[model samples]
Target chain A: MRHPYADLVAHAAHLLAAAGLDGDKPTVVAERLVRADAMGHTTHGLALLPAYLRDIGSGAMTRSGEPAIVVDRPAAVVWDGRRLPGVWLTARAVDLAVARARDYGTCTVVIRRSHHIAALAAYLTAATDAGMMVVVASSDPAAAHVAPYGGKRALFTPDPVAIGIPTEGDPILIDISASITTAGLAARLTTAGRPLPGVWALDGEGRPTDAADVLSTDPRGSLLPIGGIDHGHKGYGLALWIEALTQGLSGWGRADGEAGWGGAVFVQVFDPELFAGGPAFRRQTEWLAENCRANPPIDPEKPVRLPGSKAAAGVARAQAEGLELFPGILEALVPWAERLGVAALDGRA
Target chain B: MRHPYADLVAHAAHLLAAAGLDGDKPTVVAERLVRADAMGHTTHGLALLPAYLRDIGSGAMTRSGEPAIVVDRPAAVVWDGRRLPGVWLTARAVDLAVARARDYGTCTVVIRRSHHIAALAAYLTAATDAGMMVVVASSDPAAAHVAPYGGKRALFTPDPVAIGIPTEGDPILIDISASITTAGLAARLTTAGRPLPGVWALDGEGRPTDAADVLSTDPRGSLLPIGGIDHGHKGYGLALWIEALTQGLSGWGRADGEAGWGGAVFVQVFDPELFAGGPAFRRQTEWLAENCRANPPIDPEKPVRLPGSKAAAGVARAQAEGLELFPGILEALVPWAERLGVAALDGRA
Candidate 1:
């Protein structure tokens, strides 16, 4: 069952507000959450709402908290997320960084103490829309899921990184998780009681296992790195490096870091026109896109997809025919919408 | 046979000078070349000398050509490598980028018309030494060898990307070829009469063939992307992204664009302390390294190696026990050394 994108967002926002988040914060948070669903990244979308609501309700996440700019230099800024929702804070930080990049040529933002950042691709889209190039990385506490290459225990989060470049028509956005298979995907499989693919994970005994009990493997059952079974070392290396760049540098999440979800996030944005002449940069980026798309595909029939091309196309389709929303998401948001007095979601439950 | 790193460099410099390279340029060019050899990256090392010398002699590359800063912005710079030796220009460009990063907190440098860059790692090491994070990419013309993933025809050079981050002991350097293997490696194996590793490449008909003759296959052989045999699309994606960032943005080489031996390169440098407090950033990076290294190995005997740890360890070993030179490499530099008036190898013919 599917719902319209707006109703899903309205429901989620209503719940967030009912849970104590005030003003533009819920609106900001809901927009990103729904955008993730619209872009088809359900993992970072409303699937996280229940946990988010619980965190806020239990005071693990403070709804009223505002990110503070701790350090503001000409070329960089460090923001204490104040335990705010990562979606809102990260989006704000990236926006500020892009504005600074336009003035300073390049700018970086270090965000500390933020909670579950929804799809990183959202912030990159924001930066690229402003005609900036951006590289962003996120780190979380030892979800204890991914093992370093050649290592059996979970040592790092399958840290996610996103790089976005502005081009004509649609910018190139590359969002990659250092882990071979995303935890969310694995969790979905586990929930569905389906065996994981061979590339998904390993057992405690250092053997390949398809068991859907992903978290049960815990310190023993670990996620494989991106290059899969043999080359996971590369992925492990990349994840650890991202960890260093984001959470490590933010000065938070160090103590008890091996446990749960707290870490740093880093976002850097560049104005391409700062290096290449603006027109040239745009023309060249477009040319590169066309070159790849126009090149004879290895299969000749299949089109070579540029990183963000599909997402942009999806966005277009959503705008035209409404974004799809899952049934679980809608069912979870009904009570909150009633509490927030936001009106029922489009004549559905 | 092992030779002093300095001795090999001198031979390379001398040879280039004899081939009409500017006298002052040889040392930088040679340093980049031999550094690759010293680091055990033989593919990008002295093996490239013959081709480079040929380019210089043929007027495709020039000595005494100074790169001009074409664009200067707070966070970016564009330089015409002026057909100068790639190593010399890239070194200067990256150094300039580091300086800019120090001043601006972040900086990007794009160089066009640069000749063959000996080793991507060399440029990354420079940024790390400056306590900055770096991403570097370079694209070359179709050398008629390394293939795009899944293709029979060689469409581009095995364009490579290297990323580095600053750490306490040694910076983390992760350099990888877009191609699973290099043409030179294939050539070396053929000379040694070794059977090709399974799935490393495809023959003229696009069938999986490891005859090493994949390099000589008519219609030209193509190197598989990084995933080795299956799902090389990931590697293909990475390679295409790097090309877009560097050569694509710089308008240096398009797969079908202007024909030239020279290519474009892009380097980005970021000062971590700029975004994260200096002390916090250092602690974060250190913690990241510790967390990764603390994990127990699956093989028990084989420990996890961080990205640059091997190269740093290799450097230490070379410093103590002297660098190892391949027999073939040592034999090839004699004529060049004689031309430059440098001392020739004692054991070489």
Candidate 2:
């Protein structure tokens, strides 16, 4: 059954509020978490609510006041999240960055000690709508689930880089992890007795293995970098840089040797009006969108889909006809809703 | 026999000079070209001199004076390269960006109508060494060699992105293209009758194929984005944003529809000191470098390598011993050197 997006947000906020999130933080959390699902990234969407609640319950990530402004320059900022939920901390950071971008044509904001900010595409999409392009990169020093390109051991987090650009038709939000597929996907494939698309993971012996061979016992396989073997070096390079920007710039430790909890992030916001006139920038963006859409198609059934097109469509559909939760996602949230005494999801959850 | 790097630069400079390029521009071109080879990017190095000479000779990419500063903001700049060699234009742009970065914490310089900047690693390496971080991305609005992800025809450049980070030890430089394999490599694989690694390319029918089956006729297959088939969405997204920044921001056209012969470039330089203290930034970079090096290798023979480690080794070795050109590089250059009346490479070629 489909539920209005607003109901999901209110329910999520209610649960978060009952779980000790005070002030407007619960709304921030609910909104971003719901948008993840609305934007078609169900992996980072409400499915992660259990983990967030666990983190909150265990005091692993605590709600906090405004982000601590460690370093504040006209064009740069370092926001210590004070161990806050990433959704709340990043929401504050984005506003600061957008404000700074207005003053300086560009702004670089580094965040530390924040939990997973959820889907970066959803986070950066706002900047796109604000007529700015943003590049957001994050690394969880705590979660080292991806192996380096050729090396087998998991020494890196599946670092993600997201870029959001404003277009007339739809804002382009390209958010992708450095890994070809996620560790979770690899696990699913292992259980399903299916091979991954390619050499997208390595077994415990540090040898390449088909996904079907990733047994539950002995050594578990690690996710491969984007491009897998052929050009994994590119993804590996992207991962390294993402780490440098997020971890290095934020002064958070690397994910390799010792990783604590929380995340290190780097956000770069740029005002197109600074370089090209806003109108020209908009017009050129339209030109690019047109040319990309006009690209010759290999499959008659599928045109060259620009980044965020599908997600945008999903969001538009949800806004008009209501959003549908994954088959079991709503049901899975029933317990949390019951435990928190929040009103149960009306759509059979 | 192999000549020293300086001689190679000098010979290259002489050739460019012979091709009507005078003043410091030729030397700038020569140095960057030679450095590309020294850094182990032979494809973009002197091996590309033939193409460069042809472009200059054809007047498609002309040698010009310093880039014209069309829009200059404290933290942003729009440079009209006036169809100059990318090396010179970018060299000047980097300096201006560096200068502006010093004043504004961060600076983004956009360039229009520039030739190939060769390897961005070398260009941004200077910034890294100077205690700043820089992200460089370029798209050739005129030449589209890569198909959009899932699309058959070429609609995008093999758009390249590079990031450089400063550290106390070896700096980090990550330079990568958006394609899994280059068109040139695909062609070579086709000619050699060797199957390409994984499903790295497409066949003439726009279907995925191994390298050996690339029948390069009517519908010559285009190179896939970095993630190939499974996750090419990531690479496509990267290509789009890179285009928005380089082509869109610079007000240059996209690579599709109309063809041109130059680059639209975006270079963002940020001082790490603005966020983390310079000393802390340096220490953290060193920490990251050490952690990356210490990462357990999947193979005993190959350790995890940071982005620039291999290139650094190559540069160090080339400095210790004379730089050696690739097997056919010197031979290939001999004709151009001979045509320009420059002393031919003293090597066997």
Candidate 3:
């Protein structure tokens, strides 16, 4: 079944408000979560609402409060999210950074203790639409599912980073995790008794394996970093850098003890008008995008495309037609909708 | 044979000065190149001197000139390097960024038309020693050796990125290329009739192969991105981000056509005192480093170590004893030394 995008966002917002989110938090969180689905990141979309609701019910997530300012400067700012909705906090942070970047030419905001920010890609368009470039990264110090380059024990999370570049047409959005595969996909594959397509995980004995179940074994396996076995040192270095950008800069992380299911985020915005003129920046970016698209592809049937091209197409399709929610996503939300006394979404094309 | 570090620097500086560089340019370039050797980055170290000398002889590199200031703002600055020595340009840029960052919280400097900067890691310690975090990335618009994720033809360079994070002990220095291996290593292996240890290249037909000779074939195979075949999109995205940071921000790139053995560079520095207090920042970073080092290794005999630990040790060893020049490096420089009428270095411990 297909549901209108606006209707789905409204329904989600209503449920979040009834569940405990106050002021504009419900709307911001709902919009960003749905935006992830619109961008084809189903795993990070409405699927996470259940866990967020659980956190709220258990008082793990705080409601009705603004993030406390830890440090503020002309080009750098640090915020203590206080377990607030990460979607709302990140959205607010991007706005603040974009505004400050105009004056300072660049601005960075680091947030600690933010609840899991839904897909990093979901927050990129806000900055790109304003004709600016932005970088976003996140790490969860409380979670450990990835190991160092040659270590057998898990010591880090996926540690994802995203960059948004403005061009003449659609913005180029780059989002990637330092790990080869994400823990969410690993868990889902394990539940279905399926093996990964590639050797993306290492067993407890540090041997490469294709079985997702290795992650659930007695001694426990770990996800391989982006470079996998032969060159994982590169990925390991990248993960550590992301950790420093997020947790180290924020002054709170694994060293300070776990703070439940939350994240530490790094957001920086750059204004091209301040560096090289906007026209010059666009000229170079657009030219590169064109050349990349023209490059001959390995498979002739699948032409070369820019990083964010597909996501842009997905957003257009979802808006024109209707959003096709992933299987089980809408069904899982029904119970929450009923419990919160919110009207259920109509599944009509 | 080993040579005293000071003697090697002086010899290299004399050669550079005789070739064409003026004032402190020769000394800055010589020190940075030798520093790469001390850190075990032999490929980027003194081995590059022969080619640099040839560039000077051919008038490809500017003899003496000041970089034109394209734009100057509080937090962002751009420079037209005018084909100056990249080592000197990058070192000067880092120093300028560090100074500005002290007042602005953060500062970014982008340079276009710089000759190849020696090694990214060589420029990191300058910021780390000052208790600041720094990021450096570079791309060569005139050359392409690594292919895009799904494409068969090369559209980008190795696109190396480096980060320096200060801790209580040695700073965590991360230096990595977006590609699995660099073109210089590929060429050297091919000349020696050796195959790559892994399938790190794609032939003209986009078939994965370990033969370094494929890179020299008629159709020309290209180096694979860091993630290799199944997961190269991540690396491809990172490479594009680097291009944006270096060339796009500087308003110059591949779009301007080949400019002959030059690079576009990006350097940014951040002060911990302006973001989170310096003590709090160091506390988190130090704790994370210790925990990482303590991670159990896959091979019990080889324990886990941070990214720059080996480099730090290499520097200590070289300083204590003497520098070991890679085989043929000194021999290759002999011709340039005689042509420039500079004194040859003595190989004495």
Candidate 4:
């Protein structure tokens, strides 16, 4: 059912607050999560709420904590998230990066011990909106589905990445995971008793399997890199690259250290206006988009869609007609809302 | 047969110098090209000598030209390569970035109107060797391969990116092109009458085709991305991101402009010693490499190899034996060398 974007965000915030995330933390986390859902990225959306709540309850995640600044230079800063929510810390870090970029034309911020940042695109959204370009990367110790390139066993997380560039017409955003298929999506398909598309997964023996049950306790399966089973070296390369930028460079969660998910987060923001005039930068990007779109479509009826164009449209639609939530997601959050004494979602209670 | 790496580099330097790129320019260009070949990247190796010679002969490339610094700030700098050899200008820009990074802990350098930078890895190697982590992305004008994610028509170049992270054991180096296979590889195979590997290209109809001939002058085919036809959208997104970072951000080579093989380069450098203590960063990265390596390799005998490790080993081997040159590649460069009044590579006049 469709729910108002604000309402969904409010519900998420309330739930987090009731679960011990007080202050602006809830708002920060909620906004990022709901924004993902609004942009139709259900995998990174409300589905993670349960796991986050569990982490909070287990004391694995810290609430009401301040990320310590370890290094603060003119063009760079490194922070220790202190196990705080990644959404809040990453957003703050991106803001810091943008601010520094404004001053120096470019800046890089690295954070260690950060939690799962729900949607990286949200952090970059602010920067791109401000006429800046940003590249954000994060790594986690506990990998789920992604196997190392040319290997059978899971050795890396999906290790998602996002890049945003502002344009006068529409900002171009490219958000992607190194994995061929997301574990969350696989889990969802498994929950719904559906088969996966193509050979996006593998069983423990390095054989192809479409069964989602492979990821359960027995752990008989893993997700393939973006190139799937045959040529995943590229995805493996990408995941390794992200790991270096975030974990390797930041001196945070090394791939071999700590079994659980935790790592360094790196965000770099570049203000085009610092090097080139803002108008010119925007115009160039717009021209690029137009040229790509104006080219005759492979299918005459279908025009090229810029990277963030569809997401932006989804967001606009979500804001106009409440967010569209899966019924299962709404049901799952009901009991949690009662326990926290937070307001239930608008369409359910 | 393998030859001494120094021997190969000297040969390339002699050739480029004979082509009018003398002094530091030939050394810089030759070093990057020969190193790439020694590292097993034939695409960016001596194979490019013919094109470099052709461009120089046509006056499309300058042997000796001063790259004008267009913008210089504390955190960022932009250079006008003036259509000079990409190696010289990019190396200079990398040095500029390293200097700025040394001071501010982070810095970026962008170069416009430069020629092909043999390999992205070489530039990162320079930064990482200086004890800084680096990320570099570069793009060429449109090449007829790898359609943007959705549509069939090829619109973007197979943008290349390289990232380096200083590890306690060995710096991690990852260099990748946005496309699944490079045009050079495809062209080489097509010329050799070799069957393409497993649907690496798509016909004009967007259907999978393994025929290398599909990439012929008729241009009836385009290359697939690392993820194949469907997953190329991710590759497309990445290329667009690189474009924004290097070209758009620098206000050079706007997308719609007349297309040619020009490079827009972006280099980012960060000093680990500046953020966390140098010792701490080393310890952290060492721990990470250990964890990754120790994680019971999928194949025990083939243990996990760090990114730069293999390349370093290759360099060592090449230094002992010299850079390996394919017969076809040698044949292609003979004419160019002779035209430049240089002795042929066989060592006889």
Write candidate 3's Cα lDDT for A290-346 as tens digits: 888989999999998898889889888877887998888999999999998988887
Q: Is the docking of candidate 1 incorrect, acceptable, medium or high quality?
A: acceptable
TM-score of each model, in listed order: 0.91, 0.93, 0.99, 0.94
The most accurate candidate by TM-score is 3
TM-score of chain B of 2: 0.93
Which consecutive 10 residues in model 3 chain B have the weakest lDDT in total?
A: B340-349
- The candidate, 3 or 4, that scores higher on TM-score is 3
Model 1, span A1-349: residue lDDT tens: 3456566676778778888897688888887887777777877888778778878877777688578877788776788887788888888888888888887767778888887787887777888888877888887764557877777777677788888877776888877767766778788788788987655677886666667675675445887776667455557656766776676456665544544354468888777666564566667667656656665555766666777667777666665667766546666666655655666667532
Better of 1 and 4 by lDDT: 4
The candidate 2 chain A region of ten consecutive residues with least summed lDDT is A252-261
What is the Cα-based TM-score of model 2? 0.93
List, residue by residue over B126-182, the lDDT tens digit for candidate 1. Answer: 888777888778877435455445455565567777788776767778876566667
lDDT, candidate 2, residue A316? 80
* Residue-level lDDT tens digits of model 3 in B80-194: 9998999999999999999998998899999998988879999999999999999999999998888888999998999999999999989999999899998888887898899
Task: Name the DockQ score for candidate 1.
Answer: 0.48
Superposition error at A318 for model 2 (Å): 1.8
CAPRI-style class, candidate 2: medium
Name the regions of candidate 1 deviating beyond 4 angstroms. A209-212, A253-263, A298-301, A334-344, A347-349, B141-157, B190-198, B202-215, B228-233, B248-251, B338-343
Over A1-349, each residue of candidate 4 has an lDDT whose tens digit, in order, gives 6788888888888888878986899988988888888777887888778778778777777888688988888787888888898888999998898998898998888898887887777777889889888888877765556666545567677788889888886788888878877777888889889878767777776567777655663545677777776567678778877766677556765433565545578898889888866876777677778766775556777787778787888888888877777657778788888887877676642
Q: Comparing candidate 2 with candidate 3, which one achieves the higher TM-score? A: 3
Of candidates 4 and 2, the better by lDDT: 2
> Which candidate number has the best lDDT?
3
